[model samples]
Target: MADVLSLKQSILIYLERSGGLERLAEDCEPYNDPQRTEAVYRFNVSVHPSDVMEVDPELGDCLLHDPLTATTLFQSACFQVIKSLSLIGKLQTESQVNVILNYTHLPPFPEYTLDLCRFPRVHRPVRPVSMEGLVIAITRVTKYTQGARFLCTNDDCPSAGGFHHIRVHTPGATESAVVRNDFSCTNCRSPLTEDVKFRVLGGEIISGQQRTSTSESHCFVFLTRTDELCNSMRIGRRYRLLGIPAHVHKWPNIACSVEANRVQPWNKVSASFQRLLRETSSSLWRFSAVVAHCFGLHVAPPGSYNTLKLSLLLSLMQTTTDAEDTFHNVDLLVVTTDTLIVDRFKGSET
Candidate 1:
C-alpha cells in the first residue's frame, strides 16, 4: 500500500526532503543582509495534459503525462510551506511578494504562486486605482537621505526615547541640522526612548515614457520608495506596480510619486550583457561584408571594403578638421608608444 497525504502535506514533505524549510526561514531573518538573501517570491502555474495522440499515430505519447503540467494545487502546497513558517513565528511575510507567473510551453517550471492578503489587494481589486509604467531610472539609497527619522532618550520608561540631533558630515564643516528638543512622546506624555531596528529606504523611482509627441501625450510618474516593500528593480522595463497617493517634499498639494508597495514586470527586457556584445559583433560583421562588396572595387561603385577602410584610415591619420566644409572630423585610435615589442598578438586578429 502507498502512503497518502494532502497535496500541501506532500509538498511540505518534499521541502523537508530537499532541506529547504529551515534554510528559507533563516534567510528571511531580520539581521540577514537583504542583498545576499534570496527573496521568497511566487508565480502561478497551470495543471493540464498536453495530448496529441489523434494528430499522428506515430507521434502519440498519451501514456506519459506532460512533465510540466502544474496546477493551482501545487500553488496551494507551496503556499502552505511558507505560511507554516510564518505561523510558527519563524518567517517574516512582509518581504515575500506573490506574483503572477508568465506561462510558457517549457518542459519544467521553477516558481508557483499563492499570494497573501493586503489592504489594497494586488491580485484582483475591489477598486480600480492602479499605476502602470516603465522604470526609466533608479537611484541608490543611503542613510542621510531618509524620509523621516526621530530621536528620544528616556531610559526609565519602556516608551522612553533618546535625544536625536540630525547631523550630516559636510566636506568643509561638520554641522548638525535643526535639533529636536522634545523629551516626551507626542502621542502619550511618556519619555522619548526607542531603538532604530528597522530600515527604511529613501530611494527615488523615475517611471515614464522616454519619447513622446505633442499629439501622442504621456505623463511622467515620479515615484519614491520609502518603505521596505519596494524590492531591487531594473530600468528600461515596464512594470505593473502598486502605490498609494503621496505628496512631494515642499509641495503638499502636488502629488508626485506614490509610496510603491509592489512591482511586477509588465514587459520583459533582455538583461544579458553577453547578448548585447553578440548583437554588436553581428552588426560589425555585416558592416565588414557590406563595405567589402560595395565600395572596395568601386567598379559600378562595387563600393569596395577597400574604399571604406581607406576612408577610415585617412580620416584617422589626417587629424585636421575641415571647419567650413566637413565641420566635424573623425579621430582614430593613435598608438602613442616609443617601442613596439613583438609578441604573439603583434599580427594576430583579436
Candidate 2:
C-alpha cells in the first residue's frame, strides 16, 4: 500500500522537481473564471515542448509546461498564502490580489490582453469592467514577453553594427525603438555591441522582428579635454566639440547652447567646457565620465542615471581652479522665487 501524505507534503512533492516553489508560490491566487483560465492554460501547456510527457508509471502524467507550468506554480503559491491568511482570520472579504513583480524581462511594449468580468468581492478585480452594482473587476492581466530581444550599441558610434536592439511590439503597437548603450571597447577602441544574446542572469536570446535601416546622420561630436593637466589660466585647457551640424535644437534646461544653422558655437562651447573640466584621472575614468555626462544631458538611456549622478559628483573633486578653490568649501543656497546664491566665506568673525 502507498503511504498517505498530508496536504502540505503533497503540495511539496508535486512542486519539488519543478521551478523553485518559494518563487512561484509568490504568484498564486484564486481563479475567478477557472474555465477561461484553464482554457488558456491548456493551450499554453500543449505548445510548450519542455513540459514532462510521461511521468513514472506510478505517478500520473503532468499537466503543464513553460507558461502553463508557470501559471500553475503561481496558483499553487497563491493557495498556500491564502490558506495561511484564512487560518489566522486575517483573510478579509474577497479582493483581487496581485504580487508586485519586478520583472527584469519586461519588454518595451505593453503585454496582457484584458477582459471584463463581474464578480462579488471587497477588493476590486484584477481586470475591471464597467458594470453596475455588486462586484467590481479590476484584474491586472500581466503578460510576459520572455523572448524580447535587447540590443545595445554605443551612442557615439553609428558606423558600428547597431540595431540589434530592435524588438517587435506584440498585438500591433509601434515598432520597437532602439535602446543602445554608450559603451565602447577599451581594447579594440570600437563600439561595444550588447545584443539580446547577452542576458542579465541567463544568457538567452529571443526572436524579434526587424526594421529597415537608415544612417542616423547625426554627427556625435565628443567634446573631451586634451590629455594635459594645466591650471585654469591655461588657454588650451578647454577642448572643442566639432562636426555637429548647425540645424540642431539644444536642450532648453541645459547649460550648453545650441546653434541651428551653424556648428561653430557648438564646437567652441563644447571645447571650452571640456578644457575647463579636464583632470589627470586614468583613461577609465575619462571614458566613464564622458558616458556619465551624456546621462546628465539626458542623451543616454535610463540605465545610466545612477552611474551619471555618482560620476558627476566625483568629477567635481577633480576641478582645477587657478586659485585652487574647491567646490567643497562652497555652500550653495537657494532663496525664494528663483535665486541661487553660492556663498563662500572664510571661517569665523566678521
Each prediction's TM-score against the native?
A: 0.31, 0.19
lDDT of 2 at 290: 56
**lDDT per model vs. reference:** 0.37, 0.28
* Model 2 spans with C-alpha error above 4 angstroms: 1-69, 85-102, 106-341, 344-350
Instruction: Report the C-alpha lDDT of model 1 over 295-317, residue by residue, as the tens digit.
Output: 43433355434655656645655
RMSD (Å) per prediction: 17.1, 27.3
Top candidate, metric TM-score: 1
Q: For candidate 2, lDDT tens digit of each residue in 207-257? A: 111111133211111211111111111222222111111112234422221
Worst 10 residues of 2 by lDDT: 38-47
Decoy 1 TM-score against native: 0.31
